[model samples]
Target: MNQASSTTTSGSAAGMHPREFVAFIAALMAVNALGVDLMLPALADMGAQLGVATANHRQWIITAYMLGFGSGQLVYGPLADRFGRKPILLATLAGFVAASVFAAGSQTFAALLGARVLQGLMSASTRVLAVAIVRDRFHGRQMARTLSVAQMIFFLVPIMAPTLGQLLLNTLGPWRFIFYALAAFAAFVLAWSSLRLVETLAIERRGSLSIAALGSAYRLTLTNRFSAGYAIAAAMTFGGIIAFVSSAQQIFVEEFGMGDRFTYLFAACAFAMGVASFANSRLVERLGTRLISQAAVLALIALSVGHIAVILLGVESLVSYMLFQALSMTCIGLCGSNFGAMAMEPVGHIAGTASSIQGFITSVGAVIVGSLIGQSYNGTTLPLAIGYLGIGIAVLGVVLVVEEGRLFHARQAP
Candidate 1:
């Protein structure tokens, strides 16, 4: 889902060029993000509809997916590396669509949770394949540019997701319809992919797949402080954002009374993220990955402290809070792309395993903690603000550990 080769495979959409192919690949990867984003607005509604009273339980829908998504990648990436990207992708898409349909028909909380887990498992294939494909075809600035373009397109999900969710909620009924819509979307993408997607992994380039092979990649990635540190930093930073994401709808709609309008603010932040992502795409090549990512992390830490201070000072206004959050998200946009590339840069041969390891640690492992922090949302911004504060310090610590350098005076940043 990341890259389509003009030379290796059957070129683009018959007559389309390489750029178009990359865009299509990005779209495929971005759909997984959409699946996560589109569900935010509907979380509380779904929870209550499913007889889930405790706020914490509602997060299982998301956490379970991430867990499955993280763990599933371990197998998918290695298998794709050994086999071909196209076949693996189609199988995952088919599974994802089936899971989504089952999810739509879920009559119990457990049933829905299971479906979401399956959904995550299936979608993990797309994510790793996308990154690997990108790695296969492009490197450095070209990869960054492709990711930015894809992210720019992907940003539309946050912009449109809530409205779409709201429409389905009101027009069709409860949350099941949302899953139905997702199933339909998956079907559409799977169909399109079946005809258009290509295998980017060259046959000669295919590596042997064994537990030992994965172990070797894992050991190298984990021992290399530079890659390990940045990867962990990326995970912690993303953990902070996921903290908000896993809870924002419940806090705004259920606690603050925003209702379906919750999506608008979410979209607003997402749009800012898009702006910053596009800006990063342009500047990353010029400034280099380390500097951009470091700067963004600095901005995030600064804002996190500022946000907590403002809230604790008794000046609790929703407008001011949202403003700061949107600003932080802009920083998030600036940071996330580069962090991923930086973390995965060193592990070239086992890109799939590297990707899986990266995904598991940051998204899978960290999101669990993030979701718990979100579940601690207690009718105020305090918990959310405090969560950011903790995550900020944690991410900085990871940066320090990864670099094995001083905090304010680390000579070698990356």
Candidate 2:
């Protein structure tokens, strides 16, 4: 692999191979998942220490971060387009590290929530740039395959993070130390990226930084039927996953009495997702994005329906819940990367702005839906199961609109 020098005008990968590029991008994006998943094991301890009033109120920690993460995407997308990816990414990483430190020292629940929001806002750069970078280098089905491979690696973080969090909580004996660990991890990523990543956006191809230009880009993105439809579909499907994440700890610990075993159960579901993503990487090239995603949506809907029926019948056990949840996540694993690639496929010229708009819509929308479902937790898995079913059906409708009622038909090659 060729190392990126500071002197290049048009950014190159510095002779980085596809696997290495995929690994680097996956690591960057995984920070977002790590930020959320790693905190799950510590939520109860932190909430008690910080004087949280209710168990449900503790969810504000996750919700606050998501809101800031979503809102900040709008800012970073445009700036990355105007200023270039490398500088913006580096700055954002630094901000994330600082916010992590702030959160670690927070003495009040409100203060910790605020710091988490800042950390999430800063981390938005990693998510947005990771997608923009992939779009920078590839388009269409190849982009779908590349993203699937990256996601397959990214899923490993979710699989291991909770266990890691649990270990840290056991050894450090304080939840705040987790935030300190987060700061250290972000610092390492920042250092590695600073030394290796080259700017992918060329100077001449950059859009103007004026409000008028921004308005035009926004207009173009929203008015494009393909991009807009797929964005909505992605948002709804994404909501289902967010809902599961928000409720997983409660479902495993309180509902099923899994106790300390919750992390392993969570990891089991994550493993399913990782396997599904790897399968998507292999199948996307032959089956195409639309077919794979469409089929996965149907499978998700079926699993959700079955899960709801079992719950209603009073036959749902911990094993049954895990089985259904794993199947649902597997379907999500198949849909996510493909849906994102399809949405961004036609908007590569304005990749940063396009990604920002889409990211904003999906993240904010999912947060709203997920928060509602999470807040409805009644010491049972009913709400989560119904939420998955509702979101799956909603996204299928959106996908139909995107495809103009055509399912599984591949678009012409670019």
TM-score of each: 0.91, 0.96
List per-prediction Cα lDDT, in the order shown: 0.75, 0.87
Segments of candidate 2 deviating more than 4 angstroms: 1-11, 412-414
The number of the candidate with the highest lDDT is: 2
Residue 365 lDDT in candidate 2: 86
lDDT of candidate 1 over 166-255, digit per residue (tens): 888789987888888888887888887777666666787677777787678879877777667767777777776677778777777766
What does candidate 2's lDDT look like per residue over 1-414, in tens digits?
122232132335433566778988898988788888898999889898999979888888888989888888998889989988889999999999999999999999989999989988999888889998888777788888888899999999989999999999999989998998899999988987888887788776678889899999899878887777787788787777777777888889998899879999999999988999999999999999989999999999999999999999999999899899999999988888988888887787888999999898878887898898889999999999998998889988988887778898987423
Model 1: clashing residue pairs? Answer: 1-130, 2-130
